[model samples]
Target: MIVATGDYHVLTDILVILERWTICHRRYHHCATSLRLKCTEL
Candidate 1:
């Protein structure tokens, strides 16, 4: 498997971005669920 240096860098950047996005999305989903639960309790 031969990958160009530049392509490898780009792929690494994309993976980092995807990891950050997934973390953020999970946090947002958790917050939304909590808010909904609080609203229902009120």
Candidate 2:
């Protein structure tokens, strides 16, 4: 039971990290696209 609890905690941490990573990845992609468009216009 203790092991299961530990595993669950670890899983939650990993999920949180993955969620943050994806959020940052999306924002980076959006910023890159906007910058590219601006550069093209210039």
Candidate 3:
């Protein structure tokens, strides 16, 4: 039972980390695109 609980916690932590990583990556991509567009305009 203890082993199962530990495994579950690990899985949850991994999922949370993956979600945060994906969100941050998307934000970075958006910021980069906007900066490129502004530079082109100038």
Which candidate gets the maximum lDDT versus the true structure? 1
Clashing pairs in 1: none
Worst 10 residues of 2 by lDDT: 33-42
Could you give the C-alpha RMSD of every candidate to the true structure, in order shown? 9.5, 9.5, 9.7
Ranking by TM-score: 1, 3, 2
- lDDT tens digits by residue: candidate 3, 4-23: 88899999988987776666
CA lDDT of each prediction against the hidden true structure: 0.68, 0.65, 0.65
Which candidate should be chosen as best, given TM-score against the real structure? 1
Candidate 2, 1-42: lDDT as tens digits? 356888999999889877766666655655776654543342
Native-to-model Cα distance after best TM-score fit, residue 26 in candidate 3, in Å: 0.3
Q: For candidate 1, lDDT tens digit of each residue in 1-42?
A: 999999999999889877766666655655777654544342
**For model 3, what is the alpha-carbon lDDT of residue 10?**
93
What's model 2's overall lDDT?
0.65
Q: What residue pairs clash in candidate 2, if any at all? A: none
Identify the superior model by lDDT, candidate 1 or candidate 2.
Answer: 1
Off by over 4 Å in 1: 30-42
- Give Cα distance to truth, residue 24, candidate 1, Å: 1.0
